[model samples]
Target: MTSAGSTGWNVVQLADIPATPWRNGGGVTRELAMWPDAGDWAWRMSVADVDKSGPFSKFDGIDRWFTVLEGAGVQLDVAGVLHRVTAGDAPLFFDGAADTGCELIDGKTRDFNLMVRRGSQPSKMVRVEGRHSETLNAMKTIAVYAHHSPARVLFDEEVLQLAHATLAWRMVTGSAAVGIAAQGALWMEIPA
Candidate 1:
């Protein structure tokens, strides 16, 4: 966050959010944000701690994206097919309504999750390391989350320093050039 241009931001440290137990009893979750700020949000984001192997809650007509933020990894079962996901891997995208289950690779895992209701909210996310520089436009939100390492962003001549396990997002108003330096971080964009 910075007083730059027409956009404003909210920077959140994940540790500050209260953890809510998952209905499956497999773990807990700390919800980060939801679009519309009201009932029936189009998109949702959160950090989930998977402590054991179990089934995942279903969400019909929703697209799910998952990325490992900490710990070893997990094998996600989607419709009987197994996909191994780790911190170094790209986010896995699958149908939220699919028969999904998780098996831990070793111990518990901390993960980043984004669920977008089909047709209501479209999004794209990428795991970033090193450096990234680009011009972004026509977006409702642009967010960066530093998972296990600190990161930095430069926007509108303003610099935002993101500590470990911090999520910083801005209400994107117009096109702007952004520069980011991070390791094992998640970068996301949601169209306006």
Candidate 2:
């Protein structure tokens, strides 16, 4: 876990996260963050590499959001309904307990994922390209992920730089305007 300080915000380097093989042996996943750290989590963020077609792990009571970050993409069969998703596309949200399977559309792919326990406040993830900014809406925590391109995040008077494929996160209160400079990035807001 890479970090800038013990403050409310810090950067997480992708290279610092060890990759673990998926339960189904399809590929590996690098967990970025998990709430409560040592016990059952209310939310989690991760990046996964999909190299083969297989069924996704079922989380029973979790809500999942996914976005492709690299390579081509994958076709997801959620409860028998097929959906094709590609890099740079908006995130896809689904029930973690659903019967879901994946098929490689074109070779290997990298994806970003957020999982929130059921009954928790809803969260949002959006793909950002070039220079952009947004106001956090009563979110208790926020994460900004730089995908292929480097990014700079400005919150209040603090400025944080994120190298390619890395991410920065902070526990927030109330609302704030966040300035972002990136060629490509993903912003996620989790409610308190």
Candidate 3:
């Protein structure tokens, strides 16, 4: 249900954005926050708020994708499914409609969170570590983080340079591209 185009791609550094408090139904807290745009559905980078203890309450009406950014491991209690996630694994997607909470399995954990419209906009948070081609339809926004070498980001026929940390790109509907880099992570946001 989005009509945005592919010309919105722009790169940004993750460290450049200030961390903000994570707000949910009961106003939960997180460590960091970043996104391509502060639109209705916001993609985020969140480190755990270990300082705060939580068997915290859950939330609804949002779609969430969780990807590990650092630390040992993390697990989520969704509805009744206990999903244990580690680094370098595929991201976990669940409905925010469930009564979900998090527990740090070992040490603290850092992760990326994508909150989008339940049905109007469906999205995925992928951890891109090598060369791959992504065919993205609908309105798409990509956030790439360079963990090792500088990242080469391609959008349609254009290319942009990205440094270690985090960067974002906006692509129009029906556009796709391939990315090449030594090491890093890429999260693509799409309509649900």
Candidate 4:
């Protein structure tokens, strides 16, 4: 894990992280990052491969955002409300404590997830396509996940080459614009 006080940024390859099976035995997930690095976490980011249809893990007092990255996607039944989440769809946000279960739309699907502890850490995910630049002001941390290979990210004077499914993290304060070049990516901003 990279410290928040690190000099610049940390780039992580998806393949480098070990996969852990979901408690419900419905899928496998690779946790990308977590705050505090130990004990209870305020926020967590991960990617999961949903191979079966079943109930999702329950997390009381947590808000979750799910985005389909590959395959057809999944149909989420959140407290009786159904949501069709596909690769191109905006991330679906729901209560982690809700009675939630999912059905694979076509087959196995890969999805990205962001879980934030309610009231303590409010987070947002934005989809980025092609070339884009954004200024970070009110964020304590910013993470960029490249859905398309060979993604180029420019922060300050540093350049990072991210492979498909790879991610980069930066802890920021004040204001600065980050440049991204990719076919598709997910930008997650965590409030300080």
Best by TM-score: 2
Decreasing lDDT order of the candidates: 2, 1, 4, 3
Worst 10 residues of 1 by lDDT: 1-10
Q: Which stretches of candidate 3 lie over 4 Å from their true place?
A: 1-7, 21-53, 147-149
- For candidate 3, lDDT tens digit of each residue in 11-128? 4555555555555422223423334444543444443333222443344676777776676667778888888887777888887678776777777666666655566556766777
Evaluate model 4: give its TM-score. Answer: 0.91
Instruction: Indicate the residue-level lDDT of 190 in model 4.
Output: 80
> What is the C-alpha lDDT profile of model 4 across 112-170, one tens digit per residue?
99988888657888778788787777658888899755688887676777788887887
Model 1 TM-score? 0.91
The runs of at least 3 residues in candidate 2 whose Cα sits more than 4 Å from the true structure, single-residue gaps closed, are: 4-7, 137-139
Error of 2 at 28 (Å): 0.5
Candidate RMSDs in Å, in order, are: 2.7, 1.5, 5.1, 2.1
What C-alpha lDDT do the candidate models reach, one value each? 0.85, 0.87, 0.59, 0.84
TM for every model, in the order presented, reads 0.91, 0.94, 0.74, 0.91
Q: How well is each residue in 1-192 modelled by candidate 2, as lDDT tens digits?
A: 856575577678889999999877899999988886738898899999998999999999889999899889999999999989999578999999999999999899999999988775788888888777877667578889998799999887778888898888888877788999888999888777
Q: C-alpha displacement of 144 in model 4, angstroms?
A: 0.3
